[model samples]
Target: MWGYMRPIKKAVFPVAGLGTRFLPATKVVPKELLAIIDRPLLQYAVDEAIEAGIEQFIFVTGRGKGAIEDYFDMAFELETTQIGRGKDISALHGTRMQPGQAVFLRQQEPLGLGHAIWCARHIVGDEPFAVLLPDEFMYGSPGCLAQMVAAYERLGGNLLCTLEIPIDQTSSYGVVDPGERHGAVVEIKGLVEKPAPGTAPSNLILPGRYILQPEIMQVLGRQEKGAGGEIQLTDAMAALIGSQPFNGLTFAGQRFDCGSKAGFIEANLALALDREDIGDHILAYAADLIATIQKGRGLSRDVA
Candidate 1:
């Protein structure tokens, strides 16, 4: 099966959106650069791609996002300073990407996710590629993209990382209409982006990781604005349903939506709590904080 299909070597990262959610902080820094403990969200996504055997990273970027390009480039001054101080520089090794591995293209306008992806069509050419949104962090041992790649190798077609969420939350995500199921992989009968409340076909929702065929770019090329007056990627994806094989690979890990403020703080705490060096300390602190809040609430109840 692997030999019959074109291997996925390139990944498209749609990072062009203005991080309006983070506001003043994002005014100076790209939201993708926001740190979850120490590493930026973009780096996590890139690392996942690397782990999934991606060779080329195509970044679809917008204005004020130059820092993302610099992030993958060699840090000469910093490296020289670390070397002069006799400090360990091994940590910096993973920050720099290999030469010719990264290519950044401008989106030029604040269109939408679909348009952002179409911006990289020339680079992606006529091959299957992965799309990982930096804002959605998947915490797993094998990583989300690696899991999807493994599935792609077995069942070669468009694959989306899916997870079952509460039915009430379906309105906030692109829900999938399920058909047949094979273990963790579910056949996608249909897709509805942010379906109206109480009208979603299923509770399973897309979590921003995708392995799509290059034909999606052609569908996007002729797509008109649908939702929010922006070119909706879901709409374009829906167009390729019957003509191509579309399935959902249920992620076996938790997903953090770092695009919102609450999700960002939650991701920071979650990852910090997972670290061996600080997990216990963070757990103790969190316990103490909860105890303090509970004590204060009990006192207020008594007064009332």
Candidate 2:
């Protein structure tokens, strides 16, 4: 069994990013609160975690992120009103957590993803933990982390959910140096964070899901600023390869990068189009939009 493979009863979600790209909308509303359909981005993440048998939900948030805490708490007034009206409480199901099951930590600075994760060290204690970036949505049956947990049970050190991106685009992510290939799992030899074009070790880029050993906390503690003068978790993870057996699991699912504007819109449309409630309508609308765009482009070309 993977030495690092422990039942994933807890998960850490780092939601302290400035979300500068979203700008004023995010000034008051945490980007994690952005909705894809009827549920918020954070809600989808929490649901995924819950499905993976995660009992404790840990969020490392920043300033102006109080809404995130309230989102999981009991909305007293709303609940009271709903009860007063004798409305079905089922609508509120899955929104509230059992007392003490969910915890929140504040990452005072926007140092980096590593810093945000470090803020959760106290709550994580000395156990192997799972980290999920809310911006990266993984759609699958067993769930992304669930699969990682399974792989971890077999391989044991540090496990990351990796996927094959184009080689030219490897520079945009943490690329892994592949060692022994065993089906979907690959022994991780080394990791390079945002290597320059053509310098990446391999096209296997680390996605946002990870299951790491507690020893990583020590590595992050001593980690110096890398790349953009901010401590990168990838750098710290790279340090553990020689000491521990680190491997990457190529998951079976589609991962949506909800961090970018185009990706976010695409995720919204894709998920909406898959839902039985909205699929037909959303698909028709998308088809109409595409046709309109194509016609407009054709007319413009003819005029030119």
lDDT of candidate 2 over 82-176, digit per residue (tens) = 99999887766778999999998899888888888888888888988899999998888788888887877777778899999889998888899
TM-scores, one per candidate: 0.95, 0.94
lDDT for predicted candidate 1 compared with the true structure: 0.91
Best by TM-score: 1
Q: Kindly list the per-residue Cα lDDT of model 1 for residues 1-304, writing each as its tens digit.
A: 3225888899999998889999999998999999998889999999999999999999999998999999989999999999999999887777898889999999999888999999999999999999999999998979999999999989998999999989999998888999999999999989998999999999999989999999999999995897788888999999999888998999988899999999999999998999999999999999987998888753244553
Off by over 4 Å in 2: 2-5, 297-304
Per-prediction CA RMSD (Å): 3.5, 3.4
Clashes of 2: 4
